[model samples]
Target: MDRSRVTVVIVVLAAALALPFYAGPFWMGLATQIIIFGLLALSVDLLLGHTGLFSLCHASFFAVAAYTTAILQVRYGTPTVFAAPAGVLAGTLLALVFGIAVRTRGVYFILITIALGFIVWGVAYRWSSFTGGDNGVTNVPFPSIGPLAVTSHLQYYYLVLAIVMLCALGYRMLVSSPFGLGLRGIKASESRMRSLGYRTALHLYVAFVLSGALASLAGVLYVYYNRFVNPVTGSFQISVEVALMAIVGGSGTIIGPFIGSGVLLGLRNWVSSFFELHAAVMGVVFIATVLWAPDGLVGLARRLRKRRTGIRKDPA
Candidate 1:
C-alpha cells in the first residue's frame, strides 16, 4: 500500500484495538455488530459493486449458515470445528444452487433473489419442529476448541476482529488479482467480456457463490455472537439493510461498508432511545445519502480531499 493508505489503516486499527478499552459494554457490543454487518455488506458488494449484479438473497445464505451452526451446536452437541464449517458449507451450497439466478440480469435477478430469500425465510418461520420456530435456538455456548475458547463478549470481539481483518486482507488480494479484474470487466460490459473469450456467465456465477460464502461467514459470526437463530436472521429486510449499508457506506471500497454499518447501527441505537420513529430516521438518512452523497461517505471524503489538494496547489 501507499504511505497515505498505510497511515489511514494504522489509525483505523489503533482505534478498533483501543475501542473496547475505552467504551462501555453497550458501545463495545455495537462495535461488534458493525463489524459483523460490515462483512455482510462487503459480501453483497462483491456482486453489486464489483460485478454489477445486485443480489437481494444474501441473507438466505447468511441465515442458512447461522441456522446450520446453531442447530448443530445446540441440538446435536457438535463441536465448533464441525459446526462452523458446516455452516459455511451449507451457505455456500445454497449459493451454488442460487447461482443459477445469474443467467438473468437487472431487475429479474433482483426479483428472483427476493423470491429465493423468502423461501428460506418461510422455511425457517413455518418449519418450527426442525428450525425451532418462533422461539428459535437459544443458549448457544461460546465457541470452544479444546484448549482455546471464547468465554466473554470481549474475547469474542477480538476473535471477530481477527477473522474480519484476515478476510479484508484476503479480499484486498482478490480484488487486485486477475480474476478480480475479470469480474470488473464483466461488470463493465458482458457483451465485451464475452467477445474477449471470457465466460461471463461462469464468472458471475463464481462470484455469486464466493459472495454467498462470505455472507455465510458473516452469519456464522453473528449467530455465535447473538447466541440464537431465527427467521428474522434470513428475512428480506436484512438483505435490504445490508445492501443499504454497502451503498450508504460507499460501494466498491473495502472500508466503506464497515463505516456505513457503524453509521447506521450507531444512529439507530442512539435515535431509537428517544424517538419512536427511528425507522423513519433511518429512512431519512438513506434518502439523504442517496441525494447528497450518491457515491457514499468514502467517496465524498475522497472528493473533499481532492478539492483541498487542488486548492493547495493553486497559484493564488
Candidate 2:
C-alpha cells in the first residue's frame, strides 16, 4: 500500500477502536451492523468487481448459513464451536450447487441467480415447519467458546472488529495472489483468457463459491449480533442492497465495500427517523452515483486528488 493509504487505514482503525468511548450504544450497534454488512458487500464484489459476474443469489448462501447456525444453537443446544463451522459448511455447499449459474453470462446469469435466490426465500417463507417461516429463528445466543464468551454488544463489537481486520488482511493477500490476477484477466476478457489456455468457467465457479463462503461468514456474524434470523435475512432485496454498497463504495478496492455500507446504513438510520420514504432516498443516491460517480466514492476521491495535484503543478 502507498504511504497515504497506510496512514488512512491507521487513522480509521484508531477511530473504530475509540468509537465506544464517544459513541452511545445505538451508534456502536450501527457501526457493528455496518461492518457485518460490509463483509457481505465485499463478498459480492468478489464476483461483481473482480470476476465480472453479477450474482443475485448470494443471500441464499448467507441465509442458509444463518439458519443453520441458529437452528443448531437454539433448537439442538449446539456449541458455538460446532455450530459456527457447520453454518459455514452448509452455506458453502449451497454455493457449490448454485455455482452452476456460471454457465451463463450477462443478463442470463443475473436472471438465473435471481431465480435461485427466490427459491431460497420461498423456502424460508413457506416452509414454516422447518424454517419457522416468516417469523424466522429467534433467541440466538452470543458466540462463545469454552470460557471466552461474548457477553455484551461492546465485547461483540470489538470481536467483530478484530475478525474483520483479519479478513481484510487476508482478502488483500488473496487479491494480490496469482489466482486473483487470473480472475481479473477473466473479467477483462474471458475469450482472451481462454485463448491463453485458462479454464475460465472453472475459475469463475471457484470464485462464486468463495464469494458465497464469505457471505456465509458474514451471515454468521450477523445472526450472533442481531440475536435473530428472519426470512428477510435471505430476501432478494438484501442481495441488491449489498451489490449497491459495492458499487457505491468502489467495487474493486478492499475498503470500498465497508465505506459504502457505512454510507448506506448510516443514511438509512438517520433518514428513516423522520422520513417514511427512506428507500426512495437510497434510490436517488444510487442514481446519483451512477450518473456522476460511475467508479464510486473511492474513484471520486482519487479523481479529486489528481485534479488538486494537477492544479498545483500547472504552469499557467
Winning candidate number (TM-score): 2
lDDT on C-alpha atoms for all candidate structures: 0.94, 0.94
Candidate 1, residue 137: the lDDT equals: 88
Over 200-236, each residue of candidate 2 has an lDDT whose tens digit, in order, gives 9999999999999999999999999999998899999
Tens-digit lDDT track for model 1 on 124-164? 99999999997888878899988999999999999999999
For all predictions, the C-alpha RMSD in Å is 1.1, 0.9
Q: Candidate 2: minimum summed lDDT over ten consecutive residues — where?
A: 167-176
lDDT of 2: 0.94
Alpha-carbon deviation at 29 in model 1, angstroms = 0.9
